[model samples]
Target: MSLKVDKASMAFTFKGGMLPMTVMELTSADPERIRDQLAGKLNQSPAFFQHTPVVLSVEKLDEPHLSLERICAVCRAHKLLPVAVRGGAEPVKQSAWALGLGWFPPADGARSRTLEEVPTSDMPEESPAAAAPQAEAGAGRIYRGTVRSGQQVSAPEGDLVIIGAVNAGAEVLAAGSVHVYGALRGRALAGIHGDTRAGIFCRELRAELLSVAGNYKRLEDIDPQLLGTSVQVILSDAQLGITALD
Candidate 1:
């Protein structure tokens, strides 16, 4: 006799989600050097090392032995968990699997704009000399409604323009910039693809978190004077800076 199993009670469901992640790019593979540097950084900003999950980018290094375990230990000691590794050799990939960490290939900044050339012979005679504008990096994507709690919106290829409020617990990310026409109460992350030149502009700023490129600042780190005013967040000197927009 076989026991009956309920199909409705399928245990768990799978859904796709977008979460903010940090990347730790290793310039030097020395474990001691990494530990010392992390110590200095922690001293400067204690809140930054809060058991954050990060992906190790080893694209720049060509070391045969990366000391992956020692480096991971140092990061873990500093409250950083290595979730996976990106862009490394075959040995590094095997090492990652041995340590139960995921491995990924080298990823580009973002899906960049694509262009094609049409030969004059194949062109239509009625085709206009000046073509119409397109929705790309400059035009970007526009959202016409509010972003509620737990809702996430992203402009993966270009800018993001929101015409409504972003409630607390919500998140908005853009590859280029974020323009909020209404109140911004949730997290706003610009330059999700590592473009430091991107920025954030809001009509009323009271965001929970703001990040430009990989540099971020929480609510408590934000200036009190810029709480309810129109502001712009930018990356300056490798730090996130918020100032009233004139």
Candidate 2:
């Protein structure tokens, strides 16, 4: 007879998930040049690079040779962890394995779609990260229905206007701003592309998480007085400010 198994007692299980990861597209193969550019970016937005996991994308590089290790080192010095390499030749793939980094096919090599664009019957492996949803004819995207738990809506190009409540475990992200007509009980990330002037406005402020321009405040990190009130979250000089709408 087959033995009964308790799945909950299993020490490990593999599950698929969609996580946000930053892609560092490379145009040049010179490590020094990359270092110089990273230094400038660090100076402009220091918090944006704080131990962020990034994949080095070499699909656009025209050079025949790449100093992959040196580039990874430079990224580490700036607090950017190089977790993987995307799109490279056989030697490049071998080098990545030597460095213990995962390999991804070139963007053009694979016909992948963002999480929102994929249908249930036909889903492809996710790309490095979903390119934030673009604006339609220079205007933001609007959602008319409730965002149920575990669902995500993104308007990475402009503002995201939600006509209904964002349920617990839901998420909303935008490159410009996020405006919720109903209660915002889940997580909201505004200015995810580093737009410092972006803000988050909600009818009810019992959010599990709030972020602007990479600065985030969890529920515990928020002030007690701000809970259950209408509020706007703003980012100024890399600081997050949550103020009442009243």
TM-score of each: 0.48, 0.56
Each model's RMSD to truth, in Å? Answer: 11.6, 7.9
Worst 10 residues of 1 by lDDT: 110-119
Please report, in order, the local distance difference test score of every candidate based on alpha carbons.
0.77, 0.77
Tens-digit lDDT string for candidate 2 (1-246):
999889888998789985556667788888999999999766544545658678888987765467889999999999999999988888888899899999998874323233455443443223211222323536577765566554677785889988777876577888789999888987788887788899999998888778888788878899999888889999766789999997
- Please write out the lDDT profile of model 1 over residues 23-71, one tens digit for every residue: 6778899999999999976653344467867888887788856889999
**Residue-level lDDT for 228 in candidate 1:** 92
* Model 2 lDDT-worst window of ten: 123-132
Q: Which stretches of candidate 1 lie over 4 Å from their true place?
A: 1-7, 109-246
Clashes of each: 0, 0
Best by TM-score: 2
